[model samples]
Target: PKTVLLLFASGKLVCTGAKSEEMVYESIVKIHGVLEDYDLLFKDE
Candidate 1:
């Protein structure tokens, strides 16, 4: 299943519909990596 991601201006990520906590965390890490590639990651909190 595909998860829904909500990225805010404050660099806060809201991931929904993940089957498990581990999946959510994994997705967040991937998303952060993508953002970092573009030099858009300001915080990881």
Candidate 2:
């Protein structure tokens, strides 16, 4: 129940072995924070 590829809308993917949905969401939030901290976020829709 680990090591899988997550496909996204932009043809991007994230490989992870997260055990639970909460952990997955937490990882996503952490990555988002890192991107925001570096100003690497989209400006508009």
Candidate 3:
């Protein structure tokens, strides 16, 4: 099953439908990695 992520304009996110907590973290990490690969992640100085 695929997880669902709900992102808010307030910079808050909710990950749901995951089988376990680890799955949630993994999903987030994967997403972050992809964003990084595409240079879509914001960097703060």
Candidate 4:
């Protein structure tokens, strides 16, 4: 399965994949983890 991750200033994520729902969830969690590690999750308004 393949996937792509997109991040927006609105603190939204867009994911496109051709796999199972579990995969989508895992991908989202992983992506968020990466972003958090880089301090890119989000900031106070």
**TM-score for all models, in order of appearance:** 0.74, 0.62, 0.68, 0.70
Weakest ten-residue segment in model 4 by summed lDDT: 9-18
Query: Could you give candidate 4's per-residue lDDT for residues 1-45 as a string of tens digits?
Result: 378977777777778873888888888888778878989755677
Candidate achieving the largest TM-score: 1
Query: Every model's Cα RMSD, please?
Result: 2.9, 4.3, 2.0, 1.9
Model 3 alpha-carbon miss at residue 8, Å: 3.4
lDDT of the structure predicted as candidate 1? 0.81
Error of 3 at 19 (Å): 1.5
What is the C-alpha RMSD, rounded to one decimal, of candidate 2?
Answer: 4.3
Tens digits of per-residue lDDT for model 3 on 1-45? Answer: 378887676657899999999999988988778778999766556
Backbone clashes in model 4, listed as residue pairs: none
List clashing residue pairs in candidate 2.
none
Alpha carbon lDDT of residue 34, candidate 2?
72
lDDT of 2: 0.70
The TM-score between candidate 4 and the true structure equals 0.70
For model 2, the run of ten residues with the poorest summed lDDT? 1-10
Every candidate's lDDT = 0.81, 0.70, 0.81, 0.78
